[model samples]
Target: MSTPWTPTEFEQRLRAAGNERYHHRHPFNVRMHDGLLSPEELRVWIANRFYYQRNIPAKDALIVAKLDTRELRRAWIRRIHDHDGHDGDEGGIERWLRLGEAAGLERSALESGEGVLAGVRLAVDGYVNFVRLATPLEAVASSLTEVFAPDLMERRTAAFEEHYGWIDREGLRYFQVRPPQGRRDSREALDLVRRWATTRADQDRVLAALDFKFDVLWSLLDVVEHACAQK
Candidate 1:
């Protein structure tokens, strides 16, 4: 049998995968962060991205079901609440809607999926389906993208604040709050994957799952970039 990797080695491999393939380096995101996108391009992006945002709770729900332990379930279920909200909490979906509003998108259109591109829907749905079919370890490992997300969120928030002043400041709440939340969530998922993915095959699967997530994210932007370029 192939030797299993130590947690440190495995983690390094995962981070390397992200560094190489994550959407942060995508031309669309690079343009966004550089404050070079036209308002129409940014609006198209925001609208399509909401398709991914709204599906997060659904994706997390699938992962939660695959989790075996009540403790794991309890911890993972919070992700659903974070996006879907409970009681009076506004939740991430609502926060994203507010972002759409600030960008001048009609709430009805955003809610109705009028702005969601075909490719974005396919990619987001594919992610949810992958989580449903994945082993718990792989499903959780796919979320290691969150390990990179806190910094991305911080930079995105700064980019918007510095470059896109027309967007209502209040609508930036999702970017502001997501950094710490991503850190906490990624820590839990990393611990689980490190503990559960003990075999070489399991580690390989974990890495593959993370790469699949990168493809999903990158493909979404690919579609958006093409669509925006046509406009």
Candidate 2:
């Protein structure tokens, strides 16, 4: 018979899965963070990634709706605000739009989502749907990709400044802002998962959820890289 998993083993497995499959290792991210992507490649990334930036709030809201406690709801709601902004004049989505504009994409094209690749749209939608349908604990685990985000964001910001001279600081605002925000959010989320996952079964589910999330992130980058390779 197969051996049952323990909480410690589950946690180790989760970390291993992230090490194996996180977007940090993806070719698209590697190229972008290493200052190797062309201006046209940067434009493609900004255009495709706009879909993900826009969907994050919706994903956060879905997770919020699944939570039973007001404290959890309140804590989670900040993510929506961080992405959507107050009065539509600030926040991550706006910063991403500025990046798109710097890449020469029209505002209409971004808002309409017409320029986004089909695979990118599917991957983003799959993530939101996974959060919507998953258990609250599983939903939180799915956000663990944020744990790796700070490093990726820092590298991306540095790469843009050093190699992509066409994109000024104003255009790379989203990358500059994401590291601290991602660290805070991911820490809170990891704490919640670690604290609440007391049972072996719960830990296994959390790990699986994290693995699924990594696949979602990896799939998005794979599609982007495939397209870039074709160009």
Candidate that scores best on lDDT: 1
lDDT of each: 0.92, 0.85
Residue pairs with colliding backbones in model 1 are none
| TM of each candidate vs. truth | 0.98, 0.92
Q: List pairs with backbone clashes in candidate 2.
A: none
Candidate 1 vs. true structure, TM-score:
0.98
Backbone Cα, N, C clashes tallied per candidate: 0, 0
lDDT of 2 at 123: 90
User: What are the RMSD figures for all models against the true structure?
Assistant: 0.8, 2.3
Q: Using alpha carbons, what is the TM-score of model 2?
A: 0.92
lDDT of 2 by residue, 18-136 (tens): 77878889878887878888887878888888898899999999999988999989999999998988774499998998888887888889999986899999999998989988988
> What value does the lDDT take at residue 196 in candidate 2?
80
